[model samples]
Each structure stands twice: as C-alpha cells, then as structure tokens.
Target: MKVHVHVSLKPGVLDPQGRAIHHALEGLGFIGVNDVRAGRLIELDVADDTSDAALDDMCRKLLANMVIENYRIEKVAA
Candidate 1:
C-alpha cells in the first residue's frame, strides 16, 4: 500500500519559508498573489495490512508537530 502524508503549518503560525516564497514570486512580477503557505509531502510504501491507527500514530508521533502543524494522510489507489 502507498500512503502520502501532507504536512503543513497551522493558521496563525509563522512560516518564514512561505514568506520567502511569496516575496520571490512578487519579485518575479507575479500579481494577484495574496499569500503562500509551504508544506511537505512524504510518501510511504507499507504492507497492505497496515492499519489506519498505525498510520495516524506515525503522523502524530513523528511526522507532524502537534502544536503548530497539521497533517493529512492519503491512501493512494494501487
């Protein structure tokens, strides 16, 4: 089975990388851009029998920071 983890900063959290990217886009003459929020995608290939509980635990314990970050787990179609 294939799993994808999408991790991102929660609202009101400071994102320096996102700010930098927004600035860069403005510098490049891009317009109508209000804001930018950067995130990460982690792909995992696990056994087909892997349980949802285990995957959620993986995100809560290691993949995402419980305080300022949020994560979503996506099970990909094979």
Candidate 2:
C-alpha cells in the first residue's frame, strides 16, 4: 500500500515562500496569476493492513504541525 499526505498552511496564514515563487513566476512573464501558496507532500509505503486511523495519528503527531498547518491523506494501491 502507498499513502500520500499533503500539508499546507491554514487560511489567513502568510506564506513567504509562496510569495517569492509568485514573484519569480511574474518575472518569467506569466500573467494573470493571482496568488500562490506553498505546501508539502509526503509519501509513504506501508503494509497492506495499515489503517486510516493510524495514518491520521501519524499526521497529527509528526507529519504536520497542527498550530499552523492542515493535512490531507490519500491511500493508493501499489
């Protein structure tokens, strides 16, 4: 089994890295881009019997910072 986790800042939080990337895009001549927010993706390969609850716990405990970020999990069959 495989899992993917996306971690991102909560709404209303400022993302300086995202802002810098947006500026770089503009300098490269891309137009009409309104905004940009940066985030992280974590991938895991686990046993077939791994549970969603366990995965969620992993996210809360170590994979994400609850004070500022939220996480989403996706499971895939490998």
Candidate 3:
C-alpha cells in the first residue's frame, strides 16, 4: 500500500517562505494570486497490513508537527 501525507501550517500561523513566494510571483507580473500557503507531501510504501491507526500515529510522531501543522493521510494503490 502507498501512504501519502500532506503537512501544512494551521491557519493564523506566520509563513515567511509562503509570503516570499507570493511576493516573487507579484514581481513576475502574476498579480492574480491573492494569497499563497506552502506545504509538504510525503509518499511512503508500506506493507499491505499497515493499519490506519499506525499511519495516523506516524503522522503525529514524525510526519507532521502537531503544534503548528496539520496532516492528512491518503491510501493509494501500490
């Protein structure tokens, strides 16, 4: 099974990198963008027997920072 994780900053947290990218886009004449948020994606191949609970634990322990970031997991066909 393939486990896909997406980690992103929670709302109201400061995102300097995302801000910088937004500014750069405006400078490049792409003014339609009102806001930008950056996040990370992690893909993992695990044994078919891996449980959803274990995957959730992985996100809480290593895949995401529970303090300021939130994560979502998706199971994809191998």
C-alpha TM-score for every candidate:
0.97, 0.96, 0.95
CA shift of 24, model 1, Å: 0.1
Q: Please name the candidate that would achieve the greatest TM-score relative to the true structure.
A: 1
Model 3 weakest lDDT span, ten residues long: 69-78
lDDT of each: 0.98, 0.95, 0.94
Better model by TM-score: candidate 2 vs candidate 3: 2
The 10-residue segment with the lowest total lDDT in model 2 = 69-78
Cα lDDT tens digits for candidate 3, 10-55? 9999999899999999999996898999999999999999999999
For model 1, residues 5-35, the per-residue Cα lDDT tens digits are 9999999999999999999999999999999
Tens digit per residue, CA lDDT, model 2, 1-78: 899999999998999999999999999999999999999999999888888999999999999999999999998667
Candidate 2 stretches with Cα past 4 Å from truth are none
Candidate 1 regions off by >4 Å?
A: none
Which one wins on lDDT? 1
RMSD to truth, every model: 0.6, 0.7, 0.8
Model 3 TM-score is: 0.95
Pick the winner on lDDT between candidates 2 and 3: 2
TM-score quality measure for candidate 2: 0.96
Question: Which is better, 1 or 3, measured by lDDT?
Answer: 1
RMSD in Å for candidate 3, one decimal?
0.8
